[model samples]
Target chain A: MNPIPMEQSLMVAAMLFSLGLIGLLVRRNVIFMLISIEIMLNAAGLAFVVAGSHWQAADGQVMFLFIITMAAAEVAIGLALVLRLQSDLPTLDVDAMDQLKGGDDA
Target chain B: MFWLTSIVAIVATLLAISRLNATHALLYLIVSFLSVAVLFLQLGAPFVAAIEVIVYAGAIMVLFVFVIMLLNLGPHAVEGERQLLPPHAWIGPGLLAAVLLLELLMPLSNNQFIPTTGTAKHADHSTIPTIPTEAAPQLQERMVVGPKEVGIKLFSTYLLAVELAGFLLLAGLVGAFHIGREEPRTSAKPGAMEVPSQEGPA
Candidate 1:
């Protein structure tokens, strides 16, 4: 099998990244939003992996492993925050949690 | 092969994000992640692909699903979701994505975009023999990387980062425990507990 072009792999990563961005922007559900963030992170990791493969370096995989670790930590804290949000606010709607106000506000 | 898997991944992600049901979205997202794992495998990162499945699709999605189950969002919330996601929501992001795609493609389409030295380095693929031959040099000298090389690199050069990641994970664990823990209600009055707890000013 002929080797896949690096450009093609990068393009795929870009597409995934864009789709994830779209999801993050359009989704209102807290869970959906979190999932979108995961998609974005994975897309980044894919780019790194592809670059590593192109150059035949181990750095890309190592970077991806770190990305995975960071993502795992993020998901844990994010879910805990979600649980707290649901209990305290009684809703997961992002728009509903705008209680923060500046001093100028009456 | 890469194209096919990437198309599938993109389609799954698009379907996932467009769905109103959180569970449905999660399932589709899993599919997307799996397809990306295939792409990773094609790229020669077997270990990364494995983790993409085990850690990403398995562990992470399970966490999301658990939260979705825990929340038990009502039917009204679902109905509200449809209304909340207006047509205008697509405009901004869609435009941004288009611009990003154009930018990414421009460099790839133009051969002169890459420096001479960079192109020259990879211009010769004949030396990098994929198939083993009787007279071929030691396989260990080959550029092909596997989990073993990844581990070696991690422990040697990137060991500090690995240690830092461990610290980050520990902090996340502690934070989650601290934040998610139920606060003790000091007041004996049941009504006092009814008051909303202070958090993040929202």
Candidate 2:
């Protein structure tokens, strides 16, 4: 069995990051963008795990743990804001939301 | 050997993002995350992979799917013509990919990265106890500390952080309730006339 080197894992992570970025950039729906953000966060966590494993360092795994915690907090707040925004504005499109002057709070 | 599974995972993730359906995107996302978790296992870190699947893919994705269902996000109703990727949109991603590829893979001068010609993995295959070997980083002194170790670590070393996370979750619950459980927007009564559009400001 061929051992997967750190480099290969990193490359796969890079691809995931790119896919998420593209989705976030191109998608109009706010929910989709939020989902993409989660993907990016997951990729970052995976990278840390990869590096940590290669180095035999638990620090990377510990860091990945923190990242997950942060991600959970972020998504919760973000989705709430999006829900509020949808209430005020019928659509999730950023362009339409721009019309609401006070929507920046969301 | 495990790299093949990792490749499959990456492809699944890409497919998920490319698909138009949100549910399908999420299903593929789970597949991708699972494969990455397996890769974690192969890297001698089963603990991390377990956490990966349990926390990120399992708990978080359930919330994500629930929100999608709540939103009732569906295919575009108009859905006639589709536009190609904008030329300008490709610049940032393309450049980033090129730089990352060059930097991460450039050191493979000896091609030792493949590990195809060596006993590197074969040694760990037959003799290595999958769980114990993979968790070598955590189990140092033949301690049979199952989930209790995690509990101890979380309570002792990460207590404050855990409390903070709890508070954050509390806030989120409040916020979700605030956002999703709002009063109706329509001010007028059901039978009440929507005052005929007055063209100009008086």
List the candidate 2 regions with Cα displacement exceeding 4 Å: A1-3, A101-106, B73-167, B181-202
CAPRI quality of model 1: acceptable
lDDT of 2 by residue, A1-106 (tens): 2335789889878888888899889887777788789889888988887787676655566667778877877787777676556545556677766644434443
After TM-score superposition, the amount by which residue A85's alpha carbon in candidate 1 deviates from its true location, in angstroms, is: 0.6
Docking class of 2: acceptable
Q: How would you encode candidate 2's per-residue C-alpha lDDT over B1-202 as one tens digit per residue?
A: 3556566666767766776666666766777777776666556555666688898789888887766655543343123112223354344334433443343254234342222111123433432233324344433322221223334556677778778877877877787676555445434221222232122221
Listed per model, the TM-scores of chain A against the true chain A are 0.92, 0.90
